[model samples]
Target chain A: MYKLELKRLIKSRSTLFLAAAMLGMSVFFACVTVAGAGSMESRGYITLRGMEAIEYQRGLFAEVEGYVTTERLEEMSDYSVWARDTYGRADNMPRDVYERWISYEPILSGSCGRMSCEADEYYAERRAALARLAPSEAAIASALALNWRVDEPFYWEYGFGGSEAGVNWTLCLFALCLFCTVIAVPAFSQGYSCGADGILRCARLGRGKLARAKILAVYSVCGALYLLSAALFCAVILLTFGPDGSSAQLKLGAFVLLDMSMTGVLALCVLSGLITMLASVSFTLWLSSLLPNGVHVLALSAVMLALPSFVNAYMSYPACDWLRLLLPTGSTGLQIGMYNELAAYRFLTLGPAAIWTPFAALAVPALEAPAFALLARRAYVRHEGA
Target chain B: MNIEIQNLTKKFGKKTAVDSVSLTLTPGVWGLIGANGAGKTTLMRMLVGILTPTSGRVLCDGADTREMGEAWRDMLGYLPQSFGYYPEFSVADYLDYMAALKGLEKKAARRKIAELCEILSLTRVYKNKIKKLSGGTQRRVGIAQAMLNDPRVLILDEPTSGLDPGERVRFRNLLSEFARGRIVLISTHIVSDVEYIAAENAVMKAGRIIDAGTTAELLRAVEGRVFTARIPERELERAESAVRVVSLKNEGGGETLVRYVAEGPLLPGSDFAEPRLEDLYLWLFRDERRQDDV
Candidate 1:
């Protein structure tokens, strides 16, 4: 039955078209990103490859540390000279001074050697907030503490620069969600729509085997789409940009990507994306059982997949913080970086608390996939010919 | 096996579709004849175990189908009134897909499908897509799928609905062949389908089985009650309004031959005619026909 269902799925022309379209979209965007990076690199703005990026940052950080002095800060503090030479002009300042100033901002701010009352209060709030974390979240926070990098100079690389990786990973996940929705939206409902559900429900394999086969087929298709799209996107970006940042610290990639290896951040992002894919497929199957028409399921699922991509722009409220993280759309955002933000909650005893946004994002889908699968199975069994 | 329906009833809110329908049968074709809305479909659906009954049970070989679940389903073969097909699939592929759903292994399914294709004379069109096939051919495919597993209990609802007369005859012969050891329940509005093949006839009226017996026994209800007369063509409407006209034929200019079922002859020159399953069905469902006219 599983083999037959797979054959039927592969034979569907529309499904094939949709799969190809998903891959095409990913490849097209990847080519455009690479070309844009090449154009920027030609204009004396060099982007480092993976290992070269790590070596360049290590070299720059060491040089910057040598010049992180009170006298340099005093000179930089001189308004007339600073404004005349380096205020808004990019080419006037020496590269070493600029790198030191940018990379050691935190150290320079605390270099006065006296802790202000405001800083004291901030530390107290951070410690109190850290104490409020769940056991799992606290464990994660402790793990992160063990590998924390104090300060690292940013690496400007072809594929890893600006919002390149964030945008690429985001689109890769969004495309995966689309592929799953298109494939699974019609999974259960097509039987009903085509009027085959009645004959199937009464056959020997109809009771449980048929419904199980459909779900398994849907999962197989979704899993393939995720792997193909992720691999294609990763290959294109890494090949074009050169995999220089694999050994680089997460703090170098983004200000808040803290305490993790760059590769670890990439892996977690992909894992979070895959979790949401599972959740999307399971939820669509459940919805297909409930909805009367297959086309309606398709339409609603497309909306569910697309609407979440825009959620991060408008969603901001303390009350809705947990609600936002638990949504399927929230998982598609740059949750890898968002997990490290400590601005929202603070603990006086334990210092700043690590956010559990990505963990919650992963957990919601991990829990929802099975729950929806059960609901869908019950619906299929209880379904009459009508 | 024996199928015993001990006081089965199914109701949809305020309306009852099958009311206290009961029967016991084994190893023969039992034709359930009824008019539209006479509960033939509801009864068949319940027997197939797809719809839950409002009351009562259907026991196959003393095991209630509701409790037996898949075990009962395995013994059953059903072709619903309107079976759906995947339009893109060829006839062979459609049958193969159904065979998989029926849990037939590839080699066994191929053999069964080959045998049925010969029996149904569907060999030539086996490679044709279902959407392009004629309605009668599609119906034959439905019949072919129902017989795939050689079920112990076969239930067909309006099995001969869309077949041509020639196809209908062929289907009836096939049904007769298949009914040797299995219990076959065929529900249809076409009375001739039951005329030659049905071993026992169950007549449905409203939501109840008003009568059940051999074809000869069922015809006994209208014995000496069916009459034919030569009437003026202008008086056909009056005859139609006043009596149950089973059929009408043009005899000559300004005259018509009217065959009808009634308590007595309406015309003095009317002569008695042999009662058939048609007359029996018309006589049984006359009240609903009158309601339809109103």
Candidate 2:
């Protein structure tokens, strides 16, 4: 049955198309990650603007300039003369004197070391100094940088950069499984919705064997998708960023990405995929059983995913939280969070309606889910033969 | 072990597709003949437990199919109209997969797949993708999958629809070969497909079984009403208005041969003839136009 399911899945156009599309996307994402291009990272594009600021800072001595002092001139506190000497390579200068005058503050504090630095370094030091004066602005800027994971591109680019392909892979599998469930509606639902396959199933061994086969086939498709997606995500992440990136690593993007392990991120991705895919498949199966049309399942899933966010946004407080919780999309947040190794610490509290609910409401005769059982039963009953 | 339906009724909203239809049968080829909206398909689906009938019982080998669980399905085979497939899978792969779904053990499934492939003439295209197969071959694939478990009961709705003459003959022969110890319930618009294999036939209309007997018995019921006549195209409408015209053939030179059903007294120019299942079927279903069913 397993082998047969594999072959059958390979035969289906939608599944095949899904796999192909995933492969193509993985390859593209892998190549992009390999290129080490930062444009794809996130909300910010650092370019010629920083260079303009660098050029302007050259005119300042104590122009209250932003440039960090790379070096200083002793006799003349004029950085213009020092800049000329340094261009000739701040060569063999007196380290103590150079350091003292550059950090010196003419109005308030005594100067410290360091006169000139490169554009990035200059900005870094300037922020540090300004932080001493006004902590709010400096703190906000730093927080923003940390949020975007931009501090270290080596970690972000290498670690999470390559992870895009894998994420896409996992996402595609969820999509494929969702697709199989919905598609089965048209093929399997009629067995009962139209009652076409009943005669054959009843007269022969089809009552059990045929049903088992359909289930086996469905899961086989799901398993294949899951395995493939996992492999793709892992492979892309490894090749681009190196396998070690799955652990804690620095990253650079809009802001600076600080401490995070690669393992935690992968765990999150897998958990998200699992929750979404399972929910999708189950919903599809259930819908196929009841509805003659399969589109209803897809639509239901879409609404499930979208409604909670919409309601949470408009209602201010949770309006249909229970109803939303009934949906896979709503339930997935807890599922994903709990499954993730890093984020597993998140605690959950079930509200009033949830507390008194009977476990039987969640229990189904087979697979314990309406979608899975409905589809399987429908497919079995609707078997067409002769 | 056989199939038995007791007081089985299925409804959709206010309309009934099958109303308290019941029957008991052992293994053999049984032909279900019906008008377009007869409850044949509906009754078949209910028996298989796919569609839960509003009220009644469907039993297979004393095991009520509704609660038969998964075991009963293992021995059943089905082929619906317009079946679909992955298209990417090779013929062999598709068959093998279906064989597994039928619950065949690996070793047995493999052997069964080979046997069915050869039986269905699918061996040559075993490596070919289903999408690449011709319509006839696709239908053949459908038949083979139904036979994977050597099901005790088989239901085929319009199985020979797209076959060429040669393929149809072969398919009919194949069906006859497998009829032993198995109940083959077939419903088709084409009478000829079941003519050679069916031991008994049924005529259905308006969710009811109006006739059930041997083919000869059914044809005998309508014999006195049949006649063949050649008339000018201009008289076609007049002749049609007089009785139920079952078939019309162009005889060239603007002349036509019209075969029709009438209760008594063939017109002087027309000739009396034996009835056919096709003619009987048309007469039964065309009752709406006939305005009276006795």
Candidate 3:
């Protein structure tokens, strides 16, 4: 039964079309990221862009791919001051000078700032900022404790650009959410829309077992689509930019408090994305079971999936923020999503207790997936045909 | 096997669709005859357990069908009045899907599907999508799905509506052979579809079962009242308005043969005709037909 249900869904032209669109979107975003990649050099006024720039930056960072010791930091700082004094701006420096000096500027700048590079001053300032910005004292303490896990002498590497760009591209996740909505909104409602429910519900196993089969098949299809798209997006980006910074610390590029490598961050992002996709699909299935037809389910699910973006854009109240963060598609929004939440020091406070936004985002959808799936099954089984 | 409908009633807002209807069904081919909106479709839907009744319950073997749940559904088969199918599904795919839902094993399902396809004359179009089939062929597919499980109780609504006379004859034969020891309830306005095959018949009007019995027994009400008379062609319209005209056959030379129902012979040289189930149906739903004409 499950096999037949899966086959039925796969046979749908709309499902096939949307799946192709999703994969195309994934590759398109990857290509866009790669096309936009470029690096500036001052070697007799020669500038590199695209894959050329990426390779140039990769080679420059390869030589410095070790722990950021005091000597390296001082040497970088000395070069930065010399280049600024001589050229007045790095872009005005000679190509050889820019290649030798400024090409390594990103590594130097991120590690040397008070916001990151210096451990004691960074943490102290961070704590004060946390106390000021954190929703509660518990949040401040949580952020401080989590910050301690950031690997000291931050490991510098050359390949994080692709992984970072792939994971942080909000449009990729948004498109995926919409595709999943289009796929799942008709899971149950199609029966009603086509008038098949009257006959199906009369079958021996049609009510409960068929509902279960539909739910499982929809989840399997949508989940596989998500994994495939994410993999393809990562593959395109990583292949273009070269996979060399899998072990590099995220701290080198983003203001993330988690002590995780670039690969670890990518995994977290993908895992959170998969969970959010399932949760959103499950919610749509529940709506499918309740609505009379697929059109209504599609309209309502689309609105729901897009609501968080609008709320985050126009609203600032605590309740509005909570609503934005708690929605099933909350982690896939453009303004506030899993990637942004992971890098920001935001927290959701509940009286004295506080939880990190990334943790809350992952947890909410993880719980909602199974809960909504159960609700969807119940609603389907109990449905009375028109 | 037995299906007992006890005081079943269904209402949509202020309109009553199926009102306090009670009947018991046993193993045999039974016909439910009614006009449009006479509640035959609504009653069939309730018997299939897809629509909940506002009051009362249906019992299968003395146990409430609601409580029987899947166990009761396992013994039942239903073909709705107008059903829809996935446009992508081929006739074979649809039958296989329904077979699986009926809890038939894959091997059994394959065998049953092949047999039903052959029996229903759908073997040639087995691979064709259902949407592309003719209306009569689609109705056969619906019938095939309903009987795939060899259910103990089968309910078909308007099973022969779109079928040609030949196809309708085949369907009637199939149902008669299949219902030897099973309960088959067929609801249709075309009384003749079940007139010959139905072991018993029920007549519905205004959400109630106005009459039910064997064809011979139910015909007793209209017996001796059904008559055939020769009238002038110009008087045909007057005769139709003056009495319940079951049928009108025009003869040569400005003469028309009219079969009608009335208390006594109202026309010159009118002879009493044999009352069939259709005569009883026309007699019971004459008021509904009058309203339809208005």
Candidate 4:
């Protein structure tokens, strides 16, 4: 029975069309990420984009790729000050001097501009910021304790600017969620619309066994779609950027809270996106069981998928933020999703504990998927047709 | 197998669809005759356990069918008045799918599908999509799916609406042979479909079983009242407005032959005629037809 149900789902024209669209979007977004990449020569002349920019930057930063030690930080600071004093700006220096000296300035300056500070000052400031942001003393201690896992010297390497690919992947995940909605919204409601339920509900196994088969098939198809598209996107980006920066710390500056490597961050983002897809599909199936028309389910599912992004964009209240994080497709948004939350200091305070937003985002949907799936089964089994 | 419908009633809001109906069904072919909206479909849906009744219960061998659950459904086959199939499935695929839902093993399903396809003349279109088939052929496929499990209690609603005369004859023959020891309940307004094969018949009107008995017994209600008369062609319209005309035939030479049902001889030269189930149907639903015409 399960095999037959799976065959029925796979043979549908709409399912096939949406699956093809997902695969096509994966390649298209990967290409967009690569095409938008840009880099400049050490002399600040002869800028390049696309693969040329990637290849040039890879060689320019190769020698300085190990770790950012205190001595290296002081040497970068001394060169930056000398270049500014001699030529008024680092970009105006001679090409050889800028290539060997000023090329590492972006990594040193980062976003906070405090990357070149003394080791003691940097650690003290990070601790103070964490203490101010943490909900309680225990939370502050936990936040500071998390810093011990950071690589001691902080590895530095040319990442081919992989963050561009990461941003595009977030948008790709949003599109995949919509495509999954289209595929799953009709799993049970089509039977009501087309009059198939009249005969189906009379079959010996139609009540429970058939509902289980349909739910399993829908999950299998959606999961496979997410895995395949994600792999394609990752392959295209990794092939173009190479794996040179897999161990580079994501926390490029003192303010960024996460201490994982770039590769680990990417893996977490992909896992969260997959969970968000499953949760959205499960909710859509439950709606399908309750509603009698597929179009209505599709409309409702699409609205729910977009609601989190809209709330995150136009609302600033703390409750609104919690609402955004708790929605089924919460972590697939481009503006305030799992990928961005990992780099920020956002946390959810519960009594005397502070839970990070990234963990809450992943945990909520993991529980929702099974809960909605059970609701869907119950609705289908108890359904009475006209 | 025995199915006793005890005081079955179903209501939608304030309007009652099946009102306090009761019947006991045993092993034989039974016919449920009614006009449109006489609660035949509602009664059949309740019997299948898809629609819950308002104030009654269905018993299978003295056990409540609701408690029986899947066990009750296991011995049943049903074809609704109108049904649809998944657009992607071919005829063979649909039958195979239904067989699996009916809990037939793979080899047994394949064998039964082949046998039913031959019996229903669907071999040539086995691989064709159901939506592409003719209406009559689609109805035949519906019948095939209902019989795949060889159910002990088979219920079919309006099973012969789209069938031509030849196909109807074949269907009647099929049911006659399949109804030897099983309970086959067929609900239809076309009385001839069950006139010859039914061992017992029930007549419904306005959501109630007004009459029920053997065909010979049901026909007795309109036996002496049915008559045939010869009248002038010009008077045919006036005669139709005065009495219930079951049929009319022009004999040429300005004379027409009319077969009608009435209390007594209301024409110049009227003769008694042998009665069939159709005469009783028209006689019983005369007021309904009047309301429909108005």
Which candidate leads in DockQ?
Answer: 3
DockQ for each numbered candidate: 0.67, 0.23, 0.85, 0.77
Task: State the displacement of the C-alpha of residue B116, model 4, in Å, after optimal TM-score superposition.
Answer: 0.7
RMSD of each: 5.9, 11.3, 2.4, 2.6
Error of 1 at B236 (Å): 1.5
Expressed as tens digits, the lDDT of each residue in A1-386 for candidate 4 is 89999989999999999999999999999888888877765456958888888887777778777666667766776776677788886578788777766566655655124433454354455556768877567667667777566555566677634448777888999999899888998899998788788788788998889999999999999999989999998888889887544333323235445566666666777899889999999999999999998889999998889898899888977667678878887777656556677666667766777767778889989999989999999999888776
Model 3 vs. true fold: TM: 0.95
| TM-score-best of 1 and 2 | 1
- Looking at candidate 4 chain B, the ten consecutive residues that score lowest on lDDT are B285-294
The weakest ten consecutive residues by lDDT in model 4 chain A span A244-253
Residue-level lDDT tens digits of model 3 in A257-320: 7766666666677888899999899999999999987788999999888898899888877767
Rank by TM-score, descending?
A: 3, 4, 1, 2
lDDT of 4 by residue, B147-243 (tens): 9999999999989989999989999999999998899999987888889789999998878899999999989899899999999998988999888
Error of 1 at A2 (Å): 0.5
Error (Å) of candidate 3 at residue A145 is: 2.5
Local accuracy of candidate 1 as per-residue lDDT tens digits, A175-247: 6677777888877787788877778888988867888888888888778877787678767766655453422
Considering summed lDDT, which 10 consecutive residues are worst modelled in model 2 chain A? A352-361
The fnat of each candidate, in order, is: 0.70, 0.28, 0.91, 0.75
